[model samples]
Target: MTSFEELGLSAATLKAIAELGYEEPTPIQARTIRRMLDGADVIAQAQTGTGKTAAFALPIIERLDTRSHHPQALVLTPTRELAVQVAEAFQAYGKYHQIAILPVYGGQPIERQLRALSRGVQVVVGTPGRLLDHIRRGTLALDQVRTVVLDEADEMLDMGFIEDIEAILQETPSERQTALFSATMPQPIVDLARRYLRDPERIIVQTEQMTVPQIRQVYYEVGGRDKFEVLARVLDYESPSSAIIFCRTKSEVDALGQRLTARAFPAETLHGDMTQVQRDRVMARFRSGQAELLVATDVAARGLDVEHVSHVINYDIPLDPEIYVHRIGRTGRAGRSGTAITLVTPRERRLLKLIERSTGAPIQRLRVPTIADVIARRRESFKETLRETIAAGGLEPYVSIAEDLGEEYSPTDLAAAAFKLLLGEPPEDAEDLLAEQEPDTTEEEGGRRPRRRREQSFGPERGMTRLYLDVGRNDGVRPADIVGAIANEANIPGRAVGAIELFEHFSFVEVPSNLAERVVRALKRTTIRGRPIAPSLARPRRATGGARSGERR
Candidate 1:
């Protein structure tokens, strides 16, 4: 419950936090920021959605030396996705410092990043493997890096990045302050901390302090493809005075907005890519009651103050638990009761468990809104409208016309006709929306990885190319990390990935043969399993398999 202004941050940082609309620090933010500011190397055990990014990021930003271009801090993340997110946090928190925060990872154009590096940035956030690559290539200079953060350290160790991470740490100043944050500290992570972090202060930010007292947290387990229909059904059934739908990526926000528009919901999309003017217009519509639903990404949805919002639908579950708190916190505000429903794929069940454990609140499972439910909601809404209209008493001129119709029809028939005219025919659908719901089977699919499974598809008329990956299934690497990385960043269809095999040290996938080089080159530029991709041909399938066949003959 500590106020951010009372945390001894610089006036500039406090101003930025206020501008970002955060008046108080979450428990993790409050405890970690104070400890880190005191120059104590710290180990924090907290879940993802617990505002850990800002917990670490704000302290780093507050301490950064703006005049020097040399790296003052290096944050090593386990995945390119996380690297980007962390770097973004630095930029947001350090806005008042006029400091530069750069995200360098595999999959991005190295030359462009190198040019930026030469120009100078204050902080470098990277996957360990890519950071090591830059250190070796002389593209990055970290002689002044005073602070090092190993985020999601356990996942990094699982992915075989311990050696790479240790090497990166060695390159930084020995006098540096290091902070480590992880959900679970396995032996390797603990060992890494012991060797690198100097007399670290331990902080455990329990979720016990906070509760969503006015919010009803629920979820409907369903497949990704059926989410839109289910979302529509939920909207029709809930009939909130106003609502917001949270999406993970900008593309999702845009696509869902389009889909909702097509289905005739008064909705609009907002994301980082939109111009300020466009963002303004969307907010204007939502606030002025012209739009009923606001579909947005986390960045765009931050600090939204629409008080009438009765529900927040996480169209996609956030990557971390703190983000879940933030998303649902959008509703149940201003002393009003609110509802939050997350749509979960079965594979994310573990993630949900983690969230529940961290928050100490069990999320109730919800049945998908039925088609009959949608109709009932609409009928009720019309009834309310009818009551309001009668109260206003402005239909004197139309009374005789109704009477003329009443001559041809009985009271019941006339009333039914009037109901049809006003609210359309009541949809008599009896099917449960849950009937079509499919648990996201990607995680269980024998071949496809989770993130990449259903988000996209590649068509036929393609031959498969087998390529090597430096890390494998042993690293807790799922198909989704690979697929999400490829599809979103490489423009590769998620389905384009064919057979995959995860070995202890490496992995391989069958992609379109022609796209092999592109995939390898792209993957090399980003981190998967927390390090630079060391993609190289271990053995050509033709040569290895052909040689084996000849030996057998």
Candidate 2:
């Protein structure tokens, strides 16, 4: 409701924001920025896409003393990805200030981070796990830190970093200004605030009042490998008037869009990576109906309220629940029921539960459409096209052509041929039109698949190292709980992790030999599944449960 300049932001910060083409301050920004500039400690209730990063980043950069190189601000995030994103925002807005910001997180080589720390920077944004490591190494100095932000505080709590967060807060100067933003203010978070923060201002941003009623919502639990296949079926069977598929990241949007187009779907992509002119061209075709399918990232799709959107397919489940609400709400506008289908990978079941709980809407599980269903839908569409033509009675001009074909071929054969022509199948490949169904692939018949960037194999095998976890299945810990924590903590890709065996008393997981040491150190510093993970190179000398020789039962 307020203008950006009215929030007391520096001229350079305002200039950069204006150049980004934003004028009005979002509800969260309007309330939070004014208080932050007023030197108030604040706790804000806002989601990922609600412009919280800018609300904090703008004020942090505005108050930055560019002449002083030491980090005056510390922004702690839940994930490395978020740290990178927030750091980028600081660097962008501070270009005019000539201020430098650095992001430190695990998985990234620490030497580089230490070097950056050695050459002091103006702002430091990092994850607690890695930030703690830096602090322990005596490379980062926060004695002079003026502003500290705990971004995504609830996520940090969920990630079991509450203790580390508290310790990090203790390390910063007590006089330092603190700003906290989270969607949910759980008891643990409130307790954290009460313990450390001065009387902080509170700002809340609620969901938008209106929704696109025309869009129908449906969800299906799926795996990562099967999403593309399912999405192809949705497009093939539904044949939306013009569809826009939303992905969470620019990389995903490009990859998914390219994959769909390679399979002969008339699709194009739009994302932050694209130039403004390229975006203009893609939208021009979409608005004019030439581009039947558009794959876009969330940044590219913001403010898109297209009336003719028949279906909005979420190929990659968004990380945030509100983003899900926004993605599906893209369709079913103007009082017409449109279809919104989301594909959730098994690992993202956590996100599914959160969305259902937050939106207060039941996410009906949908069954995957089989090949037969796809064919049925395609035939039904073809029949409607034929029937509509017949009812309109405008085919008299084509009667001669049909009569001539009927003389050489039976009416059934001619009709089948006509169906093939209408659907854009080649004449030679069209014989026996209703051929047995086989899974369609991105590979063209007789053509090679695009050579994917060969992910340097970790090799056919590698040394295996084991760790002793204090708890297992009995402690509400699953393989994923172990994997997500380590994958996030060690900065290891989930796919890189190997065998896991859990038992009543403890669990042991095999990780790549090279990262075994760091993984052990990280696990030792944190708890897994609410129980401390006492990881050591040597396995637990004694058996605690019924288990196999190599794995815990």
Candidate 3:
């Protein structure tokens, strides 16, 4: 029931919090802010997504002296992403005050940090290594720092940055207020706190039950390569208004973002490699609903507090059980129902089991949505739109057109044709749908049958056209490689790709005639075996004696 007003925050701080739509203080914020403002060293045990950033940031901003140009507060985070996030939070909370904040971290040019430091920032949020580097380079002075916060202390210890942390702290004023926040009180963290903090106020925020009753947790078992296709199907079936898809690595986030965009999903990516401006733009797009999906790594998503996310998808299952909980907790907020989905590959099932055991919440298993399911969902959505449109009474023009069309066809036939047009043409072959289906058995169990071959002399199979690429066996290209490239780049079903023929210096692939041009365009934007490829429609050739040795169906 505690509000920011009752917490004794200044009007400016309260205004910023109100603008940010925070009506009440979270338990951690309520307990820690006052202690921090009173210049007390505090050690708070809290997890991510519990408003911990605001707990420290609000006090830091309120207590800062705008007249001083030197850094008064130093926040050390475990990762560059967290540093940026924390720095941004400080900026947001301190917007009304004329305080300069700089986030110094690795992966960014040190020259930028040097320039900012030279300009005299009042607050510096940085990773331990980068902060230590600045200290060693004589570009940063923490002698006058009034407050120092070690954020995610356990994470820093786990990442083996304890020495860097110790070295950085030694450069700071011994009289400075020090606060250490960690999710768990590991012995090392306890020892570090005892070594530095002087009778710090220990505050623990008890997290909600791990069952996350408001969240409907489920997972799909899928192959690593087919994850994208399965995700597309799931997105169509779920039709989530907003979603965050978590990947394990920056590369995975980038790749998945591109794939989702290529498939016509409005998606943005957040990762550690992105610059601050780029990260800001991405977050802007996502928060404004211009982008429906945000593909991100765990580190980059730290301190993200969007409340409207309808779903949280683990594109790659987290290796740690606590991380799994943190990822899904982004959704199902404020007592609102949400869905949490995870995609588990065969080898990752053991890790998934560990998460279930750790959280004491059983994630229901789901079959990867089928093409039929996607189509059915689309039809239902279309019908809803139709009903709403009819209820709105704006169908006169369309009704006139339908009447004219009725002269040529029955009403039911006309409706069917219109629905077909809305849904687009069905896949030419049922194989296209089957390709996305979850395998009933593992490959080791011989779930797959040998592909049937059509002689190269006969050219591509019916309704298929052949395309040529400039690289082949010489480029170490394999059939699977070709299929993966075309299917992923073009956002087409794998079965839509026909036979692939690998010659010494070139290769030929068959795709649906309808999709030939699109495949060519997509291939132009992709590379194979680290070599760029120029794909074009293949010219007719004389009948060959038989299938070539390297040909694969």
Candidate 4:
């Protein structure tokens, strides 16, 4: 179907889809939604981020009897994270239908769920365990359920929730329209579907169609701490008109969003933790060009159909290859060319190769943009702006000022000074730009020494304060681990972290003086290398002549 209008959806639903920026139905959505609305059992073999949620959700909402409010639909997921995400999708798509949707998961308080169930929700999206618990407590009734959806069925089978799923299905009416969605339909899933669904309509979205060919894929190998810096440089070089930056976790999204905003990138964040209103506001800002970059987690960015996105950046490479495909699929839509850039750490190169192998496409590796490259790009952009302004023929006032200065200086010199004034100072620390270059090896006593090694200093930088941690090299902690923990837990930018010095039983890390205490407090409640940490202000240590005993280089 070219448009949702052809799907026979109500006007209200079409309005909601329009406001959500959905231009057309995805392949999976196009094939599955019609059968679902026709009350046919469907078995769709599609991966996550394939618009599968909407494929089932839209039909469920259209067929729901909201007046009864006795759980007309039940959507089962393997993880609470996905349960919440799917529930949110139902809410977003069904908002016009005026139906109540409840998401029940184990980690949340049961009493709250009990009360919500008592209040009556038309749809219940939940993990099998919690849904079973509610069913056993006699608080949830599935007799009125007209639709049942098993989302990520293979994952549920992998998680050993197959029995719970069977039990939940047994509780629902056997005549209900059943829909099963899975990335891979293993034998168990197939058997379960055969036994539960009645003559299901099968739809398999091919692997070749999962990735968009219009996207130019590339990756840059960067250290974890240097990722933020590399990303900033890449953004400067690419200068995408609009971009969505995918982070692995919500905490990463928030931290990266803050860092991008601090650097004047005009970024917004979307994650599961934000309220619906907050998400709406963020999406509005992103779609309207008020925000140029959207730092988001996978679940939060799903079902988003904004067509103007010129780039999709994987700030943190996804662990799952399918997820990588989905992340990049956000761009290169509506017949527009797009770019997908990823930052890979040394340890993550294996994962990058795995993704390439799975996608059957080679991801070109490119060097991180140097400070000089960014400066040159800035100069070129300034020249383009100058040309445009001159073409507009509104330079009379500026010409008079140039004429006044022409007597004192040459025109070329005057233009050069103007260019310098407009383009601010170039980045300091040219040495840092060479950090990603292949290290030169030299013969040493042990074996070989890297010529371009990161400096190890115990003292903090001028604006930073040093903090000590109880766990270190002995606890199997690496510099990247330290940076990730601090950035994720403290909500600080990884680039803000200063020098890190690792010792046998301890380590010292630096943060901005203003955030030192906050980092310490946040670290106190967190763990590194599976061991709890005791973080505090670093105490003075005696100066040593050479490398400290048991210190890691």
Candidate 5:
């Protein structure tokens, strides 16, 4: 809870921090900034969205010799995207000071970088490969560099840039201060730190695991194709006063934002590709309530400080558990209750569990809001508006028209007609919302069950129903596949799938009776290892109360 000023930052840096609306330094920033300011070689383990960028950037910028046009500090990141992000952070924090920061990365014109290098920047943020390219060309000078930062060191190792990092470190002054920040310290990262850093102070920030308890975390297990529709359904059901939908990529942000706008959701998108002016405008609209929903990628959504955000929807789960924590942290701020909803695929169940363990909180499973649910919510909203209008007594002008209409028709009839008009066509049938699954039929085919055999029936267990799936052991199916498919498709928890009895060519899996139809419909449109499946209600067999052992192949 330390402020930047309290961390002994310069007045100019503190001003820039205030402008950015950051009042208190995050735990990582508080701990890392002081250590860096003291000129200590530090290795910090902190996740993205923990203010780690500012943690390193602020201290580096603070110590920059602005008079010298040479690069005083260098930051090595894992990707071009991260390089740009770090550079932007440095620029923002150093706006008042006469400091120049440049981001050099691949996919961008080398000439541009060369020109910037010639003009001389105080700091350079770049990826290893691109930085190494600059080093080879003698375009980027390292002799004057006094401090070096390896941001996301583990990620760099994962990308096979450890050797490049070593070469870069070797090129810098031996007396230069080094700081390495990573979410996890694998053995390779530890070894790199030991070799490069001298008597480094290890600082581990564990703030991400403590997400606000006021936030109601929930997730909808769903498929890729159905994600957007489910998002719309949840939005409709919740009717959040203000919401932010987090997507994983720029394309996803733009696509989802466009679709939401097309559906009249009052949304705007923010991504790294957007120009600064465009980003400002989008954020302005979002903060001013001109837009209700802001759809953005994680990088774009960073540093978002809005108090009225009532909901955060993970249109796509983040790559890391800590990023999930950061995304949800956007809401439930300013002592207000907020809802954080994630759309998790079945294959991603283990990841969700990891997030739960990391945050020390369980995310509840949420069913996709049905058509009926959406309709009821809309109706309630309209009714509330009507009641408020009546309470405000603003209908004095409309009373005359109402009286005239009432004279022509009974008051109840007129009110009913008005309500029908407000409701608007009753949200087309739920079956129409998606492909229809065949309904359960009790009628016998050939005076017996269609797929009946001598197999003992487990029947329905309490509030659960048995479903017969066509693909089983013969099709290379496993219990996990069935659980994953059903949980992901029907947007239910895998644990909610009751039991499984695998047979040679078919299998019977038990799912909550309430979700049986949804599970059926979801499974119908998908396949397990390229083999399509048909799920139907298992017919009853002659009473046998003993345990019905599964017929595994």
Candidate 6:
């Protein structure tokens, strides 16, 4: 409930904040701003979308003496994308003051950074590697830096930037005020704070829960190759007003964005490789509703806060379960309901379970929509658009033309013609949108799959081959446990693992034929649900009701 004006910010800082349309300080901002202004070293823990940037930026900018500019404040981020974002925030908040901020990061010409450094900027925001490079070359002087901030400290440590961070910090003045912010305080981060930070005031923001209850979480089991086709169908069926699709890598973001664009989806890519200006323009388009979707990696979308986003799609299931929460948190803001959909390959279902446990929410299993469903949704959407237009009474001029056409042809025929023009050509075939469904196997008592009685060999399936495992339902084993062990131990894509049938004494799993041996070898030494599992090739049995090798069961 605190206002920025009450945070003891300078008049210039207050004016700039007001111009930026920020009326109140967020929890992190309210707690850390005043202490930072008081020149205290603070260690703050907060989530990604919280207003941590303004918390540190406002105080650092307010304390800057623009007249003696030589990097008075330095901010180190884990990625180049974050560096640019933080630098831009500083500039926007300090617009009324005569302050200059420079962002130095990789992918940009070092000479440009050197030129900016020679001009003596008041603030320098940079990534660890490039900042350390500047430090080693004696280009970026830290003698005048009175405040040093480490943003997303945990991410930097995860990326193996601890040594570079230490090297850069060692070059700074010993008396400089230090602030570290991270979502979680891991042991290494704690050790770093203990050794370097001088009696830091710890501010721990206790999160009620990792996920927003208003967000509807759903997952669709899909194969790796069929993912894009399924994603296209989902978008068409849902038709989100505005959405952000989270991908795992920058290359994936770019490729998927381009593909979506080719398919007539208004998508823009955001990642670390983009220039600062490109990133700004992409964000502008997204915020203005010109772009319907934003495809981005986790690092690029870290501090993004877009309230109008109605949907969030996780194109790639995150290896780290905690990241799932952050990806879905991009939506369902300001008490508005939103949808979060994740496409999980069969093997990745185990990862989804971990995320559900972390977020304390049950994610519903969603069936993939067929091509007919997309077409039906489109028709309904078009009808609604026509109804709204008719209600608005904007057809007065068009009525005469319609009447003339009606004289030559029946009204129904003319209307049908118009509909075709408006809706374009509907795809005739629905096979592309329809995902292949696995056959339902009957379960015995206590919900266990009935075991096959006869000795049979593993069945063959299209793009899959069945393997036999020595453990089954009686061994406290489930499909996900088996899939997780194979996927993790073999270092293979979860999508490569297919249908799994758990019986009382043993189980059968379908995997890509090329990877069957690898999976078997990996599972031999792996444990599922604490029980050691040894997988081997199973011969096809000529049992009376045995599932065919090529078909999913």
- Encode model 6's per-residue lDDT on 276-393: one tens digit a residue: 9999999998998888889988778878989999999999876444567767888889889999999876546646775776577999987777545666787899889889989989
Tell me the RMSD of model 2 versus the true structure.
Answer: 18.8
lDDT of 5 by residue, 1-553 (tens): 5777889999999876664446578888888999999999999997665678888888898898888999999999998867866786787788899799999999888999999999999999999999999999999889999999999898899999999999999999999999999989999999998888999999987764555456899988765545665676687689888899987667778767755643346788887789999999989888888788898877677788999999999887764455677778898888999999998765466567757766778899967766556656878888899899889886788889899998789999989988877543442344553333211122221222222111112345678877777676779999999889988888998888877877556677888867776887798789997898866555443121112344532
Off by over 4 Å in 5: 1-3, 47-49, 205-208, 214-380, 383-553
**Which lDDT value does model 3 have at 122?**
96
Per-residue CA lDDT of model 4 for 108-221, tens digit only, reads: 899999998889899999999999998998999999999999999998998999999999999998899999999998999999999999999999997553454667999887
Best by lDDT: 3
Q: Which ten residues in a row have the lowest lDDT in candidate 5?
A: 448-457
Tell me the spans in candidate 3 whose CA falls farther than 4 Å from its real position.
Answer: 210-553
Candidate 5 total steric clashes: 0
* Candidate 4 TM-score over all chains jointly: 0.48
lDDT of 6 at 405: 87
lDDT computed for candidate 3: 0.79
What is the lDDT of every predicted structure here?
0.74, 0.73, 0.79, 0.78, 0.77, 0.77
Q: Which stretches of model 4 miss by more than 4 angstroms?
A: 212-553
lDDT comparison, 1 vs 4, better candidate = 4
Per-residue lDDT tens digits for candidate 1, residues 1-553, read: 5788778899988865554435478888888999899889999998676778888898888888888988898999998867876786677677778998889899888998898898999899999878998999988877898899988888898899989998998888899999999989788888888888889988886555345556899988766555665676677678777889988677778767755553346778898789999999989988887788898887788877888888899888764566677788888888999999888775467567757866778899977765445656777888898899999999999999889888888889888877777544432322432243332334332322211101111212256656555565556776667677666666888988776655444455667866765886687678886865555433332111111111000
Return the TM-score for each candidate structure.
0.54, 0.56, 0.49, 0.48, 0.49, 0.46
Candidate 2 has what TM-score? 0.56
Candidate 5 clashing pairs?
none
Report the lDDT tens digits of candidate 3 across residue range 1-553.
8889987889988866554435578789999999998999999998765678888999999888899889999999998767866787787688788799999988888988889999899999999888888898999999989999999999999999998999988999999999999989999999999999998999998876455445899998766555666686688789888899998667778767754653346778998789999999989878888788899887788889998999999988764455677789899887788999998766566567757765778999987666566667878898999999889997787888998988999999998898877655655554654554343324222244322111111234778888777677878888899999999999999988888878656678889988887998899899999987767656444221122345555
